[model samples]
Target: MARLLSELISFLEALPEPRIVMDADYRIVAANAAYMREFGAAGGLVGRRCYEVSHHFSVPCDQAGESCPLKQSLESGTPQRVLHLHHTPRGEEHVAVDTTPIRNEAGEITYFVETMSVVRHSSSRPAAQGLVGRAPAFIRMLEKVMRVAHSGAAVLLLGETGTGKELVAHAIHEASSREKGPFVPVDCAGMTETLFESELFGYEKGAFTGAAHRKLGLVEAAAGGTLFLDEIGELPLSQQVKLLRLLETGTYRRVGGLDCLSADFRLVCATHQDLRAMVAEGRFRRDLYFRINSFPIHTPALHERKEDIPLLASSLLERVDRRPGRRLSPAALNWLQGRRFDGNIRELRNLIERASLLADGDTVDLVHVQEMAEDLPLDLSASAGDAAGEFRVSGVQPLAELELAYLRWARRQQPDDTGELARALGVSPRTLYRKLRAAGA
Candidate 1:
């Protein structure tokens, strides 16, 4: 048994990615050199609980409201994969965790081997670029992005207007095998069929009245890279068949040229409209839709992941507000979070930029945000009421039902700590626990 364990440890050390071996009880029995170099800041990892080292939790990840890959692997007796936020030397980072159970000769599960892959394309904290957010919904979307990034499958980003679908598409490009290549974004909105053909398939000299010289099309320009088609739903029916033909045959020709040129580029499409309904209405081609929708991923709207407002607001402030040491006050953040952002991240950035411009001091106060946000839409159902602590409710609903809903929302806002949530709500931990249990949270 000792020799086998030694050989296993040696094998793990040979792997490049960070890996660890654990017993059935979730204790880290051994860690490879990669794991130690990456996650060994909290002293030695052997004999310590994996949850404690990764998440600082007393219990397993699932018990603390996280999807534990080890637990899932144990139950299914197979490999399990999950995206997690782990405490790293650089701070909390998004890590893709994969676990596989090891069975003995008698078919008894003896140990589990887990590998960690840090996601460099996204951040759990404020970042200068790329994706940011630690909300559950955001994590789910990011997980899908990671899963499909390495493949050559066409990706369809579905989301509402101003939800940052283009950014998400860029992230997919950056994380894919074609990261070294260019990311060409084509705005399909308001593009005419003639323009689409010439712009996408190039145009040789004298192809039309305005064509004086050979012009490279987006398809050729995006060779060995990703071609992101933004608002593909808005692409006119006449242009849909043109794109479908290009995708189906993987070949194209210049407007005035007869030679067919082979196209070599990955396709990533985004849309705010419902393509399925459009297909049924005959407004969109079923064949084109099927081709582009090979792997569909939804980019969550700001409202869908309200818990990420604070992180996103901070990140956006850093991006839009160039003034040194400029920041949003706590009250301003709370006020920003309570409002309904119908326009999603774009609206939020607009509000932040406007408030930053209005504020004289380094801190953008609640007054500044309120003054700048006067023209925005309001949610009558739940309002911030001039303060973060004040919750003004509208519409007729049972008090009990309202309480349950508010509690659920609040829990989402502070998922890690019941104690902190209770303190914020001006209630005892025990009382909050009882309420959560009764509410089936």
Candidate 2:
């Protein structure tokens, strides 16, 4: 028996899934290599209770009621299965947990075995395709994605257009155990109302016009992986009902096929529009909105988090211009900082790409930036409300007073760094500091 158990442990260790063994008392007895690699530094897990290591809970695993598979198997002498959300020792994020039981002599369960699958964002292995920026907002969103990636719950990614909601969804898939599976993306806006059902659930050969062949839907193609529905707000009301039904039962029938097929895939939806408002306007189903919003993440807009502009600009420039020593000049960066980017990160990236092409040398100067800016429609509406009322550069508002107001606004937008402001107003750092002091900022 001892020899057999030793061999089992070795095999479990070699398995790609994270595996851990817990004794009858729910105390962790052994953990495999994959488990340690997934959780990071599982040394302290030994002798600790399963709940302690898996959930950071101080109590017994059964404290959450009799639904615990480990306790159920120990009591009933029957194999059990359960899903759990577990945090790793290094506090990386939550993982999808699966638990089973190992029996000994007399058919009594002696140890509980747990398996974990780490979720990932996308199947793309390119290191350069990682989430951009180290800003607090960006990091916080990444952490949220990691936490919810493993669950069966639907995720709603809310952000302005071009905030990379789709990228975040891919990151969630990549971080999950489903990394080996396919990641399929569906653009809801592109699907006509009449074709929505067939496109999403797929159709059988001769199901409808142009249904030339049997096909696997995006959901089926993403089995054991992730299905990303972009612009979900654009989904027609009729399709919304079908989607909601599938989400509820995990069952669907291919067009022209009577047999129902079930698919197991994680769902991640993204949209630039306000889903809540759409629901109120009768354009979207309220129930569907609630269903997908189970785990919601709001991506920060570029203008709302201007402090990250420099990093974003630099990253965009590197992506567009791979030339050696390519860099943005201080003057050009200042102009970018002062101007409100109405189109958000996408617009900024486009501008940088154009500026890089127009730049004569490796250094992108203000002239190149200005040339690009000239082509862009003036964003007067962006600053109208804040700079228009009682804060204008005319009348009783002296140059110093105007500077103070602008400084205050600038500080609010880009705190912790005045470099952008200095460049925007075309002043030396020392001069900007003296002016700020004079204005009592």
Candidate 3:
């Protein structure tokens, strides 16, 4: 009988859920491996009160006064079950608990055997593998992107800067039948007006000054693949005309060459700018706008989809942990959710990376995040205040006026290029020129 009891105890201990044996006084006699893993220290639990092991409290179990399963099992000398929200040193966990009284030879309750199984929170939809959120707007956008991925038509992604426009473009390309093809990205804003033509259409040897060797442009290089044109609104008007021509006939010639080459690649363009508005204002070519906007997808800004912030923060923390042991604390996550991420995902990533570097321990806390926020050269709060002040003073100025104010503020804060602001505000150089024209700046 003793051997059988020992084997039974071992079997219960090996169960996935936590198990424990306690005396009538709630003193823990034995705890299983799962309990040890969760409580962090099982050895010290023996002969300690159940409250000490589970709740880290010195008093008796709070539920014991309300017909608790453990108390009931001991009093009635019968098995009992209950669902509990258990608080431990780590965190709160939902559990299904069962307690059975062990009887002595004379039929008196000797000990209570407790078994617990964690209750997992059920999710309504299958979680997105690499993405986040299940909000209607987010789901609708994702569905649209999936639907458009099978078509061969050119896709134009529209969104604010840091809204993950490039990510959506890449998703469309990867989900399409052209998944096997290379995804080539070209930053249209990075090139100068003079360098744009040679870079996009390739240049022949000695095509222009310092053109030493024949080189293939991004268009030709992405043949049989997908060419992602990022910040396409930044393209010069002259380059827009050439790009439109290629879209119309898929034919282009190297700079200074008569031979025309045809590119058999998929085209995906992304821009934070409003091409339709630009076209209406005579800044962007109407024909070019129609050509590239065949199928359009808009990525939501971080603020617009605040519901996904928690998941995004958790994923970012996991990514941060990949480098080292750095992780986000609950306080840090709460702080992040409350923050105004003007730069959106890009800002969040930068903040996380900075916090990881500055964190003294594995867990990133609120102080670390606050320090990182303070370190940001651009005072986002002050910028927001200035914008509000301008709005109040001007009684709703034109977007151009607001943009100029924002640009001036951003330029004053950071010595780097104003390209980020230009993109985020969704204004082309020509449109910005018109803003300057109107403002007389």
- Of the candidates shown, which would achieve the greatest TM-score relative to the real structure? 1
User: Which digits, one per residue and each the tens of the lDDT, describe model 1 over residues 226-268?
Assistant: 9999999999899999999999999999998999999999999
lDDT of each: 0.88, 0.73, 0.69
Report residue 60 deviation for candidate 2 (angstroms). 33
* RMSD in angstroms between candidate 2 and the native structure over all alpha carbons: 11.7
Q: What is the alpha-carbon lDDT for the whole of candidate 2?
A: 0.73
**Which 10 consecutive residues of model 1 have the lowest summed lDDT?**
378-387
lDDT of candidate model 1 versus the reference? 0.88
Task: Output the number of the lDDT-best candidate.
Answer: 1
lDDT of 3 by residue, 355-377 (tens): 87777776888888878874322
**What TM value does model 2 have?**
0.60
What's the true lDDT of residue 44 in model 1? 79
For each candidate in turn, the TM-score is 0.86, 0.60, 0.56
Question: What stretches of model 2 exceed 4 Å from their correct place?
Answer: 1-127, 322-325, 375-441
Error of 3 at 333 (Å): 0.9
